[model samples]
Target: MPLVTSRRFFELGDTVWARWYSARKETWELGTIKEKVGSKMYKIFIIKYEATCIRHIDQLLKFTGNDNSLKINNTDNVESRNFQSLPLLPSMPVNAPLSEPSVSNLRSSTIVEQPVNTDAIDHGNGEEWGDYSAQDSVGDSTKIPEASDSPEASENGVEQP
Candidate 1:
């Protein structure tokens, strides 16, 4: 009998940590192997407990559970690299019924990673002016600006000759 060299060996209902790509980058998230779509493609249900996604065999790295070299299963630690950082929800069932959260059930969301201005202005009147982030969002627009769409409007939105 020859030693198996496959980087990973997973099946349906197996709770494995698969690599999921969002946008262009990669994220090693906790997921369940829902179905083997083909010879290589696999449909995975993300345990972020949200959307379902698909990945290829090469993309599915083996989940090496701990640094002690004690793996959860035989095929888990057969990979080259040690993936001790891979998160898992062992107590959670791989085939557990999913309940998709509605939009209203979700909390307020915002996108980050935008450029932040390092130069913050201090007005000295107990006020600091700087770029507002989604987390510590500045208050909403204090007052709505009067419409200045009319062609005859002047600099101050006043009618001009």
Candidate 2:
């Protein structure tokens, strides 16, 4: 009767696939059957199935003969033990003093107040005043001589009246 139960289990697996297939509206095919030992007391059969002929798998397994003697092997204890034995390194102190001089202190001694020029300093070149006088003559038109109204008038007295 184990084969009948296994067949019923396979049918249950088909029901699960049918539910999913109908929900998604797609075709699925069955693949290899493998048994997995879950915990210490229960043996599970994982059936490989395909969806849309893509070679997929599904698992459908429960306790055999209604016996609840199955125990799940706990692997979390090993991780917890390793974590407990791990050495926590101390963090380095961040308040160490700097060995180099700061920008403010380095620039403080080098900054000297430049003396302001209160007395007029002579440049010793007379061309400076010549340029200034030229600029003044150009700016004031009264300094320029006006052209005489009589075009024939001569300064040396050699022209006609």
Top lDDT hit: 1
**Candidate 1 wrongly placed segments (more than 4 Å):** 1-8, 66-161
- Candidate 2, residues 1-161, lDDT tens digits: the string is 44543233332222121111332233221122233233221122222223222112222222222112222234322222211221222552222111323345433246779996544333675334433654564685555543442454556454542
Q: Write the per-residue lDDT of candidate 1 for residues 22-95, one digit (tens) a residue.
A: 54435566567889998788998765645688988765644545434434343552253344545345653232
Pairs with backbone N, CA or C atoms under 3 Å apart (clashes), candidate 1: none
lDDT value, candidate 2, whole model: 0.29
Query: Model 1: how far is 80 from its true place, Å?
Result: 25
Candidate 2 clashing pairs? Answer: 49-56, 49-57
Off by over 4 Å in 2: 1-7, 10-23, 36-161
TM-score of each: 0.36, 0.13
| Candidate 2 lowest-lDDT run of ten | 11-20
Give the top-scoring candidate (TM-score).
1
> What's the CA RMSD of model 1 in angstroms?
18.7
